[model samples]
Target: MKVEQIYTKCLAQGAYYIFSEGEAAIIDPLRETQPYIEKLEQDRAKLKYIFETHFHADFVSGHLDLSEKTGASIIYGPTAQPDFEAIIAEDNQIFEIGKIKIKVLHTPGHTLESATYLLIDENGKESAIFSGDTLFLGDVGRPDLAQKATNLTQEELAGMLYDSLYNKIIPLPDDITVYPAHGAGSACGKNMQKETIDTLGNQKRTNYALNQPDKEHFVVAVLDGLTPPPKYFGMNVSMNKKGYKSFHEVIKESYRALSPEQFENLATTESIVILDTREANVFKDGFIPNSINIGLKGSFAPWVGSILVNVQTPILLVCDKDTEREAITRLSRVGFDNVWGFLEDGIQSWKEAGKDLDKINRITAEEFAEEFTPDAVVVDVRKPSEYATEHVEGAYLKPLSDFEEWVKTVDKDKPFYIHCAGGYRSMIAASILKYNGITDFKEVDGGFGQIKKTKVPTTDFVCPSKL
Candidate 1:
C-alpha cells in the first residue's frame, strides 16, 4: 500500500492519494487535475473514487474534472446534494479499494456533509483517518461558515461539532495517524498546528479543542476569535457546490499571449484588471500604470482571493516571461479563471515601446526614521491582530485584506507611509493604492520588521515612548 499527502503550501491545503493493488483514491483535490491523473498513470493504477470532505470554501476542488476525465465515482457524505452527480454516502458506509477498505465516518459540523475517511489496512488494522476539517492537529474547523447552508447558527454547528468529535473521532484508537485537511495559515481553523499530519494520541493530549471543559465551552472557544473569511470564500463555496468551469477550459481560455499594444488595448477596452506577478522590488522600480502588484513569491492565491473579491473578475497579466502560466494557475486555484492574456515579452517590451509607466516611492526603514516628522501619516497594513500586538507609534491600521474599504478614509491629497510585517504586503498595498488614484505615498522598504529594529518608537496598546 502507498499513501502520499500532496500538500500545497500556498493554500495550506492537503490532498491525499491512496493506492493499493492497482486501485487508487483521491481525497479533496485542488482545481488542477493533471497531477492526479499523471500520478495514477505512473502508479499503474486506476482511479476508482474521488472523495470530497465537504463543499470547500477556501479553494475550488478538482473532483468534478477528475471524475469527468477518469470516469471515477465522486463520493460525499450524508446530507450533501451537489449540483453534479455524486454518491451521497451513509454514516458508517464502507467502500472497498484494492486490498483495503475505506470506511466513511460521517463527522459533520465543519459542514453537514463533512466526512472522515478511515483507511483499514489489508490485514484489517486501522492505519489512518483523513480527518478533513472536522479535526485539525491543534484546532477544529470554524463553525460560522456552515450557518448559510444549514440555516443553523454557529453555536448550533459548534454543538454538532462537539457531538461529532466525541462520538466519531475521540473514540478511535490512539495508534492511528490523523491527517487533517489544513494547517496553521488556513482560515478554516482558528488555531491549527503547522504540522499537517499527527497521531490521534498526540492530538488528544495536545489539541485544545479536543480537551475542552465541555461542549458549551468548546463552542465558545472555537467561535471566539474567528475573523471574517476572505471576500471570495462564499463565492468559491458556491462554485464548489453549484459546479464550475473545467480547469482545462480555464487554462485554454487563459493561455493567450498578447503583444504590449494589444494587451494595453484589451485592458483599456474591457477595463480588466492588470495583475503584475513580479518580485516586489522589481515591481516597485517600475510597472504598468494601475497594475496591482501581488508578487508570485508569497501566498499569492490567498492574497489575490482577499483583494479581488469577485472570482470571475476579468484579469490581464503583466508577469515576467515564462511565469504567466504559474500566475494563471495560482489564480485559478483560488477560482479566478478569467485571465484574458499576458503581456508578451514582459515589461521590457512596453519600456522599449516608450509606453507610460508608474513607480512607487519607497524608502528604507532607517531612512524613514531619519526623515520622520511629528504629523507624518503612517499606515500599518498588516492584519488587525498583528497591528494590535505591536506597531509603530501613530501608525493607523489598514489591513491589506480590506484595502479597498479602509483606504477610502485616507486623505486623497495627503501622502502616507505604509508598511506590513515585511515588504511584500506593503508593495501590494502600494500597487493597489496607485491603481485607485492614491499614489502620493511611500512604502517602507522592510515594513515593521525593520522599523521595529530601528530607533523608531513602536509599542502595543498604547505606545510608551520613542526609542
Candidate 2:
C-alpha cells in the first residue's frame, strides 16, 4: 500500500493518492488533472474513484474532469446535492479500493458536505484520516464559508464543527495520521500549522481548538481572528459545484505565445488586464504600463484572487518565458479562466520591440529612514498581527488584504511611503494604487524586512483590548 500527499505550496493545498493492489483513488485534487492520470498509468493501477471532501472555495477541483476522462465514480458525502452525477455516500459508508478500505466519517463544519475519509490499511487498522477542512494540524476549518449555502449562521456552523471534532474525529486512534486538505497560508483555517501532516494524538495534545472541550470555547477559539474570505471564494465554489471548462481547454487558450506587438495591441484594444508574474524587483525596474504585479513567487493565486476581484476579467501575462504555463495554471486555480495569452519571450521581447515601459520609484530602507518625517504619511501594508508585533514608528497601518477599503479613504494627492513585510506586497500595492489614480508614492525597496535592519524607530505596542 502507498499513500502520497501531493502538496501544492502556493495554495497550501494537499491532494492525496492512495493505491493498493490494482486499484487507486484520488482525494481532493487540484485544477490540473494530467498529473494524476499519469500517476495511475505509471503505477499500472485502475482509477476507481475521485473523492471530494467538499466543494472547494479556494480552487476548482479536478473531480469532474478526472471522473469523465477515467470513468471513475465521483464520490461525495451525504447531503451533497451536486448537479452532476456522483455517488452520495451515506454517513459511515465504506468503499473498497483493492485490498484496503476507505470509510466516510461525515464531518461537516467547514462546509455542509465536508467529510473525512479514514484509510483502513490492508491490516484493517485505521492508519490515516484525510481530515479535509474538518481538522488542520493546529486549527479547525472556519465555519463562515457555508452561511449562504446552508442559511446557517457562522456561530451555528462553529457549534457543528465543535461536535464534528469532539464526537467524530477526537475518538479516532491516537496514532492515526491526520492529513488536512490545507495547511498554513490557506484561508480555509485560521492559524494552521506549517506542517502538512501530523498524527491525531499530537493534534489533540497541541492544537488549541482541540484543547477546549467545551463547545462554547471551541466555537469562539475557531472563529476568532477570521477576516472575510476572498471575494472569489464563492465564485470558485460555484464553478466547482456546477461545472467548468476543462483544464486542457483553459490551458490551451491561455498558454498562447503573443509577440510583444500583439500583446500590446490586445491590452490596449480589449478590456484585458496585463498581469506581470515576474519578480517584484525585476518588475519595479521595467514592466508594461499599468500592468499589475503580483509576482508568481509568493501567494500568487490567492493574491490574484483577492486583488483582481473579478474572476472574469480578461488577462494577459508578462512571465519568464518558460513559465507561461505555470502562470496560466495558477490563474486558473483561482478560477481566472479568462486568461488569453502570455508575453512572448517575456519583458526582453517587449524591450527588443522598443515598447515604452513604466517603472516604480523605489527607495531603499536606509533612504526611507534618513528622509522620514513625523508629518509625512507612511503606510505599512502588513497584516494587523504583524503590525502589532512591531512596525516602524508612526507608520499608518493599511494592510494589503483590505486594500479596497483603505484606498478609498486615502488622499490621492498626498505622497506617502508604502512597505510590506517584503517588497513583493508593496509593489502589488503600488500597482493597485496606480489603478485607483493614486501614484505619488514610493515603495520601500526591501520593505519592512530591510527597514527593521535600519535605525528606524519601531514599536511593539498593542491596543488595550488585545492586551
Least well predicted 10-residue stretch by lDDT in candidate 2: 458-467
Q: Encode model 1's per-residue lDDT on 1-467: one tens digit a residue.
A: 99899999989999999999999999999999999989999999999999999989999999999999999999999999999899999988999999999999999898999999999999999989998999998999998898987899999999999999989899999999998999988988867888989999999999888899899989988887678888899999899999999988998999998988898888885558999999998998889998999999889999999988899899999888899999999999889999999999899999998999899999999999997886889998897767767888888888888889877776889977999988999999998888888978899998898998888888855441221
TM-score of structure candidate 2: 0.97
| Candidate 2 Cα errors over 4 Å, as ranges | 461-467
| lDDT of each residue in 1-467, candidate 2, tens digit only | 99999999999999999999989999999989999989999999999998999999999899988998899999998899888999999999999999999999999888889999999999999999999899999989999999999999999999998999999999998999998999999988868889999999999999989999599988887888888898989999999889899999998887799988788889985667889999988898898888999999999999999988788999989998688899888898889999888888899999999999888889999999898877778899987777877888888998898997989888878899999988989999998887677878999998888988888888865662362
**lDDT (0-100) at residue 142 of candidate 1?**
91
> Pairs clashing in candidate 1?
none
Q: Each candidate's root-mean-square deviation in Å?
A: 2.8, 1.8
